[model samples]
Target: MKKLGFGCMRLPLKVKKINSSIDMTKTEEMVDYFINEGFTYFDTAYMYHDGRSERAVREALVHRHERQTFILADKMPVGMLVTKGDTSRIFRHQLKKCGVEYFDYYLLHALNAKYLERAEKLGVFEYLAKKKSEGRIKKLGFSFHDSAKVLDRILTRHPEMEFVQLQINYLDWEDEKVQSRLCYEVARKHGKDIIVMEPVKGGKLADVPEKVKELFALEHPDWSPASWAVRFCASLQGVICVLSGMSDMAQLKDNTGYMKDFEPLTQKETDILKTAAAIIKNEETVPCTSCRYCTASCPMNIAIPEYFTAYNKRLAGEDYKLYLEERAKDKGKASECIGCRKCEEVCPQHIEVVRLLKKCGEIL
Candidate 1:
């Protein structure tokens, strides 16, 4: 385990579906490359890739490799839980889907203030503890997406949680809205091992603003922008692994190449990133992670994530019209949002999807 985990959320799409159609051939290649390079941690969720990601993990990694060689992690879909019974049912279902008898890591998916309340009411944590006790879950944890106060409360109540998955990146490290620093400090204070997600801020920091890019260049000329962001999270003290949702061969190679022999950032390099974060903080960009959670239940079938990506690129002064056109080919334009905020409800980043879609379509 080289502190780099393969996130199966954004597996290469085989074709354009409202959700996604995973290209298994390329996914297998990515998984094999990752394992061959000595990385084993793989993270998937119940709703990732429209609930098909776990099966894809089976096909791409689990079926091909020996179980002992890789560590598989899955989460209970907290948003979709209708009853305490559903937790047990979905856990069993996930085991069958991933073709495994037990999960190396099991989590309460997207544990936030709202979900935490619901999960407690439904006895979700207690059920997971039973699973861990039964050997179905090796380690119990939750992926958090709320404030530090909420985190402290949960950890205090549920000290049984073995680890925590947090969204950590240089850009959001000190952002008031994200509260990455605060949440991270809370996790550290609890004495928990941390698995980092969104280290590159959903690819936004990978293609940063010119000034920010230049700052990174001056610090490490050969390092890619993504390398700096990923390494920033990996360099942190308690981060057990930094998960990158690599979508293609290029991203896979780039991430694994840099992480093969990991190094921590020196004080001066950390200072440069601090300067880079200051410049990025000034940019007015949509804070979407392209999670596609918004489009999961969109009545109009809008390509919400794609629209936001193009809009962000435009804010960066790049050509985005063609990309927008391609993204809107068979899907609803952003103008068709109809003011329904179903997207906002499930979005981990709390983006104003309807309003941002209106602006993105206006640009088109």
Candidate 2:
């Protein structure tokens, strides 16, 4: 398989809203293009697209292709587990949802500090190991969001984890809050192969500021900004795959074009990316990836990512009234957050959601 994996989290949507229905026809086209180009890995989760992504995979890929031709990855939402038997119930449901008898890669999704405790109490690791022994799961791993210390502790306790998925990109590589480098080092220290998520920071790096765009254009005018971002992660030694949640054909083509003949970055390119990262750090923009992970669990049903997008555009000098017009459609504003903190717990970026929502109250 190639280093590029097709991420199904942000499949093309029929509507533009967060809970909009997927455009399965377009998704099937994108899946065909990806596999024909020799990329074989497809990643989906139980909560992605409001539990529609797994079914999208079944419709677009599994029904159309040979089972042995591709590798499919699904996740168990450990954070959403409320009962002792939820693990097995969800695992069986996922297989039925994805229309697969087994998963090539199965993960304990979004393993943070709180979720880790729940997983241990529920005997999640033991359950996954038993499934792996039964040949229902070929590879067992977890997608992580906490600090390096937590990661080290987990690895020490569960040496059975075959791979660790971390959010690694040039922008967040040295970020104190994200701790991408530290987590990468921890995974490598434990001799775990890495699978990278959010390589383009959920499209933030792909559409950077004019200054950063010009920097890339000056040297590699032919390459898309997303290419540079994905390659930066793929260039790393222990990284087995970099997943891009491609939403359209252009993105799929752009990714496969560069990844077909993969190349490690030169020292000069590395320095250029570091400089771009510095400029991005100085910008007064929200770090939200627009993944909508926060919105799924919000008690007040606030459209957190949409508000953040509006807030970011406001920071970029867009009119405030325009943001208000968009916010009207959402029907839930930032001021309605109520400090529940459920959104914060599931966020992969580890953003201070409550504080940011208060700021959004002031700005949007």
Candidate 3:
């Protein structure tokens, strides 16, 4: 397998708000293409697409191909566990949902300081160790979203974790809030291989500012901006797999085309990326990563990520009127935000979502 893993979070959807409305035909085609190209790793979670992501994997890949031909990874939703049995219940449910007898890689999903405490209290690590000993899970790890200090503490306490999945991209490598480099160093200190998520910063780096695009074009006119972002993450030491949440065929093709013959970015290209990151930071756009975790529990049926994407486009001087109109036609607009701040609580980036929505109401 190449160093690229297929991320099953943002699969093509037929409807806007419904997670169960996955476009299975397109997804199956994409999966066939990916596997035919010799990439086998796939990563999904319990909460992704409201539990339909695992089911989609069953339909698209597991049922069609021999299980031995692909490597499957799934996560236990540690953040949502309120009782000791919750972990076991969710794990069993995930196995049935994905139609798998054993997982190639199993993770404790979305661990931060608070979630880490809860996991310890709930004996989540002990449970994972038991599962691994039983041969149900080949490898155990965790996906993290926290500061470097917290990461160090977690790794020191749980040295058994095999790998650490992190949000590593050119834009967030040195970001004060993300501290991608700091977190990565902490993981390496514990001798863990890295699985990179959000290598494009939720597609923001793919649709970069014109100035940054010009810089990239001048240097490597043949490469797409997304290729640069993915290559930057793959170039890092100890990175084993870079996950791309491909939503369509074009993205899958572009990603595999470059990653098939992977090459580390040159020193000149790395410096250019640093300059581009600085330019992006100065834009001061809302730093929403579009994980869509906020929209799952929303009461008003607001499409928070879509609104943020449109608002960011407007900030980048792109005409967003038509986009805003279309979004409003299908889902609640930003003006409909009720100041409940539910979205802000779930946002991994710690984005002030309510304030940003208010600003989006004004501008978009």
Candidate 4:
């Protein structure tokens, strides 16, 4: 896999949907530019953009480009599967959606303590092994969203996994809940290669506060903040690639520019990032990681993850008020949490979801 993989999660949207109406003219141009620049890895999941991501990748890259030219990676949506048979159905559907004969990488999507247990009890890992043996999937691993301790357990138990995908970035390097660095270390200790996702924290690092942007601009005014993020993930040893969810032509162009050159961060740049991380750490409200385990058990159909994401932005104070206002428009407001502890039950981070929702309601 290349050092920079294009994440298909936050692809261009139209009418608040995945925008199956992909800007193919520009997207095709971006794909040509990306491959010409020597970056060839693309990551998507079944649930991303409500299943439109797979088809979009087909239209944007797979159909237009040769199979061997790029590595296509997708994850099994284990959370949505109600029975063991659903795995084959979704995997088969993915093959059709992406217009691919085999996946370069396949993952057990978004594993945590609960989901891992579910997958194990239901024989998902074994099923993936069979698919690999049959040559439908090339490499098998998992995308994780839990604590370091849970990660340690998973790696210890599943040494057959080729690599692990993690949500790693400067912001969550030492986060108590996310523990990006801790999970990376755990994987490395197990001798597993890492696929880094969210190196830019869902594009939060792209356009940051003026002060944060100014700090980075002092180093290289020509480089976008996105470059620094890609460099940060690239700087980490044992990483196979850093996934960037590019949504527009400008972002794709800028990212491919830096990724083509593929330079890791310098010692000075690392120090600057560390300082910037500190600045961001002190500003976050609730310290939520947006893992969405809370949503699994919500009885009132509350969108706990969305609320927490919005609440964190509210905690960032004045600079992120726009984010707070936008997310607050959702039907599942913090005030609608219903005080159910169901969300807390599945949270590996043990976040006080109900109480925090209450606090967010007060603040926002």
lDDT of each: 0.89, 0.90, 0.90, 0.83
Off by over 4 Å in 1: 284-364
- lDDT per residue as tens, model 2, 282-354: 8667789989898889889887887778877765434555566766575677887789899999999999999
Better of 2 and 4 by TM-score: 2
What would the TM-score be for candidate 1 when compared with the true structure?
0.80
Poorly placed runs, candidate 4 (over 4 Å):
16-21, 284-364
| Residue-level lDDT tens digits of model 4 in 92-201 | 99999999999999999999999999999889999999999999999999999999999999988999999999999888888888999999999999999899998888
The C-alpha TM-scores of every prediction are: 0.80, 0.81, 0.81, 0.79
Q: Compute the lDDT for candidate 2.
A: 0.90
The TM-score measured for candidate 4 stands at: 0.79
RMSD of each: 9.7, 10.3, 9.5, 9.9
Writing each residue's lDDT as its tens digit, candidate 3 over 195-279 gives 9999987777787777888989999999899999999999998999999999999999999999888999889999999998888
Give the true-structure RMSD of model 3. Answer: 9.5
lDDT of 1 at 354: 81
Name the runs in model 3 displaced over 4 angstroms: 284-364
lDDT of candidate 2 at residue 226, scale 0 to 100: 91
Model 1, range 1-364, lDDT digits (tens) per residue?
A: 6899999999999786544689999999999999999989999988999889999999998899999999999999999999878988998899999999999998999899999999999999888888888999999999989888999999999999989999889888887767899999999999999999999887778877778877877867889999999989999999999999999999999999989999888888888889888887676788888878888889999998888889888665456768878777899878888887888899999888887778777664
At residue 6, candidate 1 shows an lDDT of: 94
Q: Count the backbone clashes (under 3 Å) in each candidate.
A: 0, 0, 0, 0
Q: Show the lowest summed lDDT stretch of 10 residues, model 3.
A: 314-323
For candidate 1, the 10 contiguous residues with the lowest summed lDDT are: 313-322
